[model samples]
Target: MSPSASFSDVVRDRRAVRSFLDKAVPDDVLRAVLDEAQLAPSNSNTQPWIVHIARGTARDRLSEALLRADDEERYSLDFPYDGSAYEGAYARRRQDQAKALLDALGVSRDDEAGRRLAARRNLEFFGAPQVALLCVPGFAGARITADAGMYAQTFLLSLAARGLGGVAQTTIGFYADTVREALGLPDDHKLLFSMSFGYPDKRWTAQTPRTYRASLEESVHFHE
Candidate 1:
């Protein structure tokens, strides 16, 4: 995974890695990745995305708070997330993706307890050493959030280029208020999502789930 590798290589190598080794990433390497991600283009050049990285004690506390929120069934989301929105093709895709991961983990759909425990893995940061919480302005519309999304993609690709891997979890956004309070963030810094990143653990077979994308014809629109 050389820095000079082709864009295609990085794109192909990049996947949602659900498991990571306990090894800590070097500060210089992490800084380099963040610097490269900062090059992501933003609307009006207003880089509205703010990222807070948690490690060691901070990471433990944040994870604990999120876990407690989940245990209590309390969610303080800045954005709406409803399973009902996944209709038609979206629903099928969502179901297939979940099945792929659960199958790899040996968790059956009928095993409600197993599924609940598996779902808690997101709060655990998949055993990664570092968790980065991405935030955007609370009042900003979708357009502003789109800029943050681009930044996030760039950040993930940057990590991939460095032979590191991560998984972005929107579930972290469910406990937005808890996250903000734990991180001591201002009210305006709304949580968009969070990511757990580090050296991937090859021993975890669940990290290599079989997944696919729709064909270009089905996903793209062509115009003369």
Candidate 2:
């Protein structure tokens, strides 16, 4: 960790790490990062996020389950995505991000097989040593999901602060049933997303792509 690291520096250094080294983070470091994430603000102090970390055999089992579910086309999501919602500017942004990622991976836009293989890497956690699944008890409403998003950001930032990296993957949430079954989670623990985290693999050239973000003028508004 650099002693001169500022908050902006940490945030700037963080990215959606697509590959990771096969290394188990020290227990103490993981615990400390989680402790920091626990301080993330929540509405009414509910702090409704439930996190499940998979490592060793557990991680392997979950990965296998997700892969099988994907192969079988068995998707049982707790919250289904509405593809139609991403229209116009939103759709364009999504497409641009996809193209950037595919280019970084050296996969042609028309290469269906290559794209499928790249998508499958999400299930494999990009060779990460550990995967953390975040959830909420009972049916997840928009408010709880928003709170969970906050928790997720704090968790990622915490990892960044410790010189670690993670990717928040909603793709895993599509196989919520498989994940819950593999992790032995109750039905009420609705899976939100998964974070595959560890030391970033510098050898993975695909991690070089930095996603584009809209300017503040395009995304934010002020009222006084």
- Candidate 2 structure quality by residue, lDDT tens digits, 117-213: 9999999999999999999988669998999999999999989888889999999999999998998999999998899999998767345778888
Q: TM-scores of all models? A: 0.96, 0.96
Model 1: clashing residue pairs?
none
Error of 2 at 148 (Å): 0.5
CA-only RMSD, every prediction: 1.4, 1.5
In terms of lDDT, model 2 sits at: 0.91
True lDDT of residue 178, candidate 2: 97
Given candidate 2, what's the lDDT at residue 128? Answer: 95
lDDT of each: 0.90, 0.91
Could you tell me the TM-score of candidate 1?
0.96
* Number of the top TM-score candidate: 1
Error of 2 at 156 (Å): 0.2
lDDT of 1 by residue, 1-224 (tens): 33776899999878898888999889999999999989999989999898999999999999999999998988998988898888988899999999998988889999999999999999999999999999998787898899999999999999988889988999999999999888798999989899899998877844556589988888899899
Q: Cα RMSD (Å) between model 1 and the true structure? A: 1.4
Model 1: which ten-residue window has the lowest total lDDT?
202-211
